[model samples]
Target: VTAISGSNVSLQISNLSTNYEQLTWLYSAHQKILEWEFNKTNLFKSKFKNRVSLSGNQALSIFNVQKEDSSTYILRVLKESGKEEEWHISLEVFDPVPQPNIEIQKKQEVNNICHLQLSCKIPDQSITYTWYGNSRALAAGPQSFMLEITVNSENHSTSYTCEVSNPVSSKNDTVYFTLPCQLGKKYSWGWEGGHRVDEVKKDVGIL
Candidate 1:
């Protein structure tokens, strides 16, 4: 099972019979997390402290989970008939995805074709990025963070979205190309004439 960091997660032992004499939960097969002696007392590990709990239905819950809590857990039940049953569960914890930012790295018009280079501004290399145009997926691969595309000047007024995701969460941001890519049009970002400028009008002969 996969869980987001700082969230609560529960691992349940389903169809547990009532004829069990003792119930125990182990971490990584050796470390005992908790044990319940039937009708007697419950013992919990000091490491877990107040962060872990066992429900009446034999569910193990952890609050405010962290990446360090990801591991394999085993639930062992000692039946009254001298037989033992076990259930194994694996948990994976991942950090929540941050909201993505789309940046125009380069944009220029040549011969009526608008060339654009975009990037998803996320520093994490473990995350995957996907590009979309007008709500449709682009040709960029699932793991690509940079996207380059060309559009006719007449059809350049569209929106492009960048989605960044991990195993547990996803976030996306969009950039709108509402202004025409005509000569002398003003742009707030991207390169012009091999120099970086902001909120400037394009020159008639610059690319």
Candidate 2:
């Protein structure tokens, strides 16, 4: 059996002996009769039913089918001597399930640098990753699990989330960071600054 077109499938059988004089094809769905072709044209078609064709040369083609329509196809050939040979074909369709996983790490901490290293752990099946803050995407990224926040002041007290998705499913994770920045005091020079400047100048002149 071979697929002749996107919507069509072809089954071929060969016979070297003159034993078979006639061929008949029959099909069923969930054990219910759906189509039967006997000594007719090579093709069978119906708008309300699936498209199946039988050629004069003992080839069968089924088209426009769905997963639920899959079943076993039985072909019988009758010989001129009143003997018959039978063959069977089974059809199966499959689709993959989408993978799900978390996008970012569950917790994070910010340092005095006001920077943070955020991470996400996505399921191995995920294909892409998206990070968001306040419902906006974090920008360009490739994978779903691994990410770096680059640690910035804006990350403080912000509710960040990572959303991971693929063709079939999606998953997400959120974390908040409150960065601790310790401010230092700046020294100011007054009359002390003027006295220090004069003292330094006098010492330099004396030397």
Candidate 3:
């Protein structure tokens, strides 16, 4: 069916019989061919000599698979009693997922609870989304494209990240939320040269 790049994959044959006169492998897409008989295999096409192989059970093994290797493969077994059997297998390869974009659609505070909503901008429906809070994984599943979280004053200065991924690759983006900073002021008096008094002011910011 499907395989990613740089991975090894094999196509297996069932009901194998040792009485076969010869086993042949034909790559329908590139016109590459191979034949095995009497424990000896004849390989054609130098391009596939190192990556393609036929096992003892007539299985095809492809090593260090690449995107260009996506094609249909056919295996033909010639029996000693003058009968032939064939197997067809299709392979597909995909690239890694790219970085994702996140949007903060809405944020509102009701009573003492803040409601935050977010969405992923990617259009691929097959991709899955996972939510994390301060590097801790949330209870999320594959269908959670949109997220709704409720935060209170206890959760101020928090961070949330969304990891979008598929079977081959993953990417993520993060957002931070901060509470309103508290400002304070203090006033003090200093004596001038025994006649007048000067005033000084100080301001402080606390989170």
Please list the C-alpha lDDT of all candidates, in the order they appear.
Answer: 0.72, 0.46, 0.68
- Model 2 local distance difference test score: 0.46
Structural RMSD, model 2: 22.6
| Residue-wise C-alpha lDDT for candidate 1, range 47-131, written one tens digit per residue | 6667888887878888888888889989999999999999899998887666665666888878777888878767776677787
Best by lDDT: 1
Tell me the TM-score of model 3: 0.56
The TM-scores of all predictions, comma-separated, are: 0.77, 0.38, 0.56
Better of 1 and 3 by lDDT: 1
What does the lDDT read for residue 198 in candidate 1?
39
Candidate 1 runs further than 4 Å off = 40-46, 139-142, 154-157, 179-207
lDDT of 2 by residue, 1-207 (tens): 322113445655665254566666656422322223344444233331446655555567567545454557767767779887777777553222122222233234345344334555543442466767556777435553554545456544355565654433344555443332321121111111112211111111100
Which pairs clash in the backbone of model 1? none
lDDT of 3 at 71: 80
Ranking by lDDT: 1, 3, 2
Better of 1 and 3 by TM-score: 1
Model 1, position 63: C-alpha lDDT score: 88
lDDT value, residue 126 of candidate 2: 25
